[model samples]
Target: MPSPRRTARQADLLERLVALLVAEGFASFTLDDLAERLRCSKTTLYQLAGTKQDLVREAVKHYFRGAADAVEKEIAETVDPASRVQVYLTTVAEQLSSLSRAFLDDMAQFPPAREVYEANTRLAADRVRNLIAEGVAAGAFREVHAAFVGEVAAATMRQIQLGEVGARIGLTDSEAYEQLASLIVHAVSS
Candidate 1:
């Protein structure tokens, strides 16, 4: 069944909810806390989702959805296959720059939110693979195993999201992503 369309007010509330969670993390926020922070009532929050956990999950999904759209939009503006791959990863990094360490830790602890991130990572890997394949076909990149590169990139992204990369290398997730983009572009260049 089709879901009911969101009203402008609900959309604005959701955007605000996403920004607040991205800035501060959601695990520490109670429904009442979200209500007060968002300047809405608990009942209004319930209209967005049924419970606090669901609300957090919804916000995480919303954040990724918006990020995906933004990445694609930027990629569309770039013509070269190599540049597309670079643009894709760098845009992803930019989108993720807003995520606080607290938010990453909270996502790791929350299975639903963690799963959303995992699924998004997998999709991004596929996108990288496609972009690399395009570069090879276009002669913008040398012949290399696109799938292997994509999987490696995906693994790095997972570690970045998990905070393992930062713990070991002291690089923020965004920095790691930018490095990954550069590495992939260099590796694929003819």
Candidate 2:
């Protein structure tokens, strides 16, 4: 087993590397490429994972988990139901702002990374559904089936990621998500 200090140091390295992975991509970058970009030795990166694929998968998972946790924390601090959903959407967009198209495509190409993304998507949908219920109860939102609306919102978000809505409308994916938050807030406003 690795020493606790060594494990902590490896975790720190992963944190440093995830941003590079987001801006560049995982699919095409070699281990040497990653080491050079990170300004670290290849051996140091190897200590984080046995192989490049494992490192990419683990970093992608860490990114999603960290982003999700931050969103949840922000939502928890708010009592306003409308703000809860808005916070969720806004935080999601902000977290993904640095992510490049190439990086996103790489995630889609990797099954393990894709699974991590999909899991976050599902969790966001559930949280949105709950927020809708809260909003309706508090009369902050119009009377509607919260579950169905949340599912629709989640589905639309997926299309935005696919570049369908953003492509036709000439907006980036991050911009599309911001627009979506606005639309959702207005649609449910009482």
Candidate 3:
């Protein structure tokens, strides 16, 4: 079911809620806990969604939507086509910084929220491909296989999301992403 239209107050509350969920996660938070942390009543919380799971799903979607918007805005304002790819990847890294392990775990437990994350990653890969094409057209990047590059980036991102990087290297997901962005930018530099 669709959520009710959020008033300005509710929209503001959703931002706060996303921040909280990013840091702590909703899986462990009861409705009362959410009300306390979000500084609203249980009734107000229910207004956001029909149930706690529903609330969490909406919150995850909201977070991804906001992140996607910000990433697109950053890419749009960028002047260099080669740098667009860098900005795209690094913007995602910056967004990943706010995500805590608990939050990731919560999403893993919730398939719908996980699907939202996966969809964003797929879109990210597509954006990477587009940036590569732009760079090639502008003579900023070498004539290389953009599809192969995109697939590699997408796979690397998948491993990162699965915590394989952290599991093997003892680096946090955010740190891994930061390094990945740096490496990608350096590689793409003319």
Candidate 4:
């Protein structure tokens, strides 16, 4: 196990990295930029997280970890699978809406960041899959492929985050979430 001090340092570095990613977007920063912005040396960052891709991965993971925590909390608190899924989707929508446009604009410029983003997406999909599987076992949801429903739900969440179809349909984030939740419930409930 890592020492407590080392763990704390890693946490601090991750926090700083996340703030930088959120503020300037991943494309706006190089090793030198991060070194200057965080007042640390490139060597230190290298020691902390080998490559830029690694840094991006860690930062993206940190962001999604927080999202997952929220989803977990929602699951623990909600008795019904449908309500739990709605809370999870709505929470994600709210988070995406709160993200800085600069963050989104910058994210567009980085392929690695996109990859990291997609990985987090799969993580979210797995969470939804687990939820669906549990619901099915409890007879709250009809017999269906949990993985397929999870993938669709995850893709729908991404669509909302990207504001592609949701904006075209004149749906606010909450409205889009409700619509998605309704569809998910209809598809899964017996």
Alpha-carbon local distance difference test for all models = 0.91, 0.82, 0.83, 0.71
Per-residue lDDT of candidate 1, residues 40-149 (tens digit)? 99998888889999889888988998999999999999998879999999999999889988898899999999999999988998999999999999999999998898
**Local accuracy of candidate 3 as per-residue lDDT tens digits, 1-190:** 4456879999999899999999997688999999998889999988888898888989998999889889889988999887888788878888888899999878877887888888887888888877887887898888877787778788888777777788899877678767777776666656
The clash count of every prediction, one per candidate, is: 0, 0, 0, 0
- Report the candidate with higher TM-score, 1 versus 2: 1
Query: TM-score order of candidates, best first?
Result: 1, 3, 2, 4
User: What TM-score fits each model?
Assistant: 0.96, 0.88, 0.90, 0.72
Clashing pairs in 2: none
Q: For model 2, how does the per-residue alpha-carbon lDDT over 119-165 read when each residue is reduced to its tens digit? A: 77777778888888999999889898999989988897777755677
Q: Write the per-residue lDDT of candidate 4 for residues 8-115, one digit (tens) a residue.
A: 766787788787777667766788988888888888787767898777766766776676677677678889876666666666656555445566655545666666
Question: Model 1: runs farther than 4 Å from truth?
Answer: 1-4
Candidate 1 vs 2: which has more lDDT:
1
